[model samples]
Target chain A: MTQTRLVEVRQNVLKHNDVLARELRIRFQKAGVFVASFVSSPGSGKTAFLEKTLTKLRSQYRITALVGDLATANDAARLARAEVPVKQIVTGTICHLEAQMVSDSLQDWDLNELDCLFIENVGNLVCPSSYDLGEALRVVLMSTTEGEDKPLKYPTIFNTADVAVITKMDLAEAVEFDLKAAHASIQAVRPAMQVFEVSSKTGEGMDKWLEFLQAKFVDGQV
Target chain B: MHELSIALSIVEMGIEESNKRGGAKVDAVHLKLGRLSGVVKDALLFSWEIACQGTTLESSRLEITEIPVVVHCENCKTDRTIAEINNFLCPVCNAPTPEVMQGRELEVTALEIIE
Candidate 1:
């Protein structure tokens, strides 16, 4: 029988992605662009919300986006209607957007020409939490129909995000959504997490969200 | 769903590490897994076998050391172990613990191998 030995391996499993993310962060910082990535469960209004954001902020900032999905570029097509540079990263079976994907997608683009860049991750709460795409802000969306216990059930997602947006608030009343309970649940998992309630259709409560981005672009740290 | 890819990454990392040490056969990998790491242990375990198949880490085991969630309470001025993962409030002052001191680790600490 061969004798066994202990190998000292003090490496993080996701160190490769983390290193790439740090490199991307430096590149984005040098280019003076503020990056924000959106994450949500399927059908949580991420596309609609991003569309509204793109349409609203297109002229103010030289905006561009890279949207990721498991299958089609349908969401990218939808976002293109906003009349900004929008590309789709078809991840196929990948559930989250890694730093390498972001790096590969930005190969031909001039990052300095843009003021802000957004990455819409593949609709997932769990896996996306583990990977960082070099985003200055990570936004998580939860629609009213998804229930108030969502933050409680998927606490890790809430913990990983910088802000949470309650989308489709126009249907809140129709869905009998308890706004108080939802806020309480978000607070329960992530205390003092900035939460926004907005309806992409009606554009209610969007001004504040837009204003928040404006502030970030101006005062955002590299 | 994404656990398979994560498992594959872990296997790849393990293989690279073991190969650096003169192509030793990996016996097991020790990991520091925190509760708030967002990785499902069962799903990861299920995917490990498939990810390791035909790889250098093929029969190797994954040893996970679970780390509990610890939060720093501003009001209490002490780090407290969160009793419930959902309710992130300080038990002493009922104040929201805004700081997470631990429970988000995902590190490969060590490996057992044979020459």
Candidate 2:
């Protein structure tokens, strides 16, 4: 006697969370909330930059942020002072933040209430490049002290990013930061990428940064 | 560090593939990992054994084939393999290449299972 066992199994590798992320993208699009995510190595001043950005844009637009860290809600607490609703996703030991986590955490908040949402991804340049967080834009951050070869060292992340922000420009001279080399490196990976140089401490280049946000959300409204 | 997550994905995919063939236990999974895929081979192999514990891919072996980065030079009109990741310019013309023909791939190509 011969017996046949019928089995039905069809699944995508990232099936479980990708579906939720897709739905979240739809929700964000419908509400006209432009989402932006930041990625960089640890201690690249991501939170500090976001704090300044959120503080400046809070009055102009309904802004909220979701920050991710391996542990602690420190960034969330710091950003809440800007008076915009903020949440932190503690990824435990995870190196990178996934899209599903963002969707799950923001389930309680009304998407229409906010004009823009920023997701500060877990600070890692390499791994975060592979995962899409359903954001309208992805910005890669790098500080002057981290050296100018960062973009070349990690081209994948630089290539995936829509924009590159050079942080801590106030200390550029102290660290002997090579702006030309840095720009060249980024251009090599992604030519014609929009690059922003700013220092959160001195508020240098904040105007351009703010204008960018306004244009992206308020004027463009895409 | 993210190898564990990748290993989990491999296990999940292997389990689903095995289940499709009448729930046979997977013996191994073949993966084509490119040299510039940004995935550390040893780290992934180490994480795979641990990630397979209490899973359908517990006995599965991970076979990896490393593919070299190949780039097409518009200036020279020739395809060449880059021996090092840091070298981004074409060897003959010294011009920067735009299109990378091969490498930088991470995928699960096939699975071996036994009934």
| Top candidate, metric lDDT | 1
Give lDDT: candidate 2, residue B51. Answer: 88
Stretches of candidate 1 off by over 4 Å are none
lDDT of 2 by residue, B1-115 (tens): 7888988987988877767776677777778776666677999999989988987778678988788878888888999786655556676777776567877667777676665
Evaluated on CA atoms against the true complex, candidate 1 attains a DockQ of: 0.83
What is candidate 1's CA lDDT for residue B100? 95
Q: What TM-score would every model get versus the actual structure?
A: 0.97, 0.86
Candidate of highest TM-score: 1
Model 1: fraction of native contacts? 0.90
| TM-score of candidate 2 against the unseen true structure | 0.86
With a 3 Å backbone cut-off (N, CA, C), the pairs that clash in candidate 1 are: none
Put down candidate 2 lDDT per residue, A1-222, tens digits, no spaces: 434233223333455556766777788889989999999999999999999999988877888999999999998999898888999999999888887789789889998887999999999988887677888889999999999999889887876788999999999999999999999888777656789999999999888987886788755454
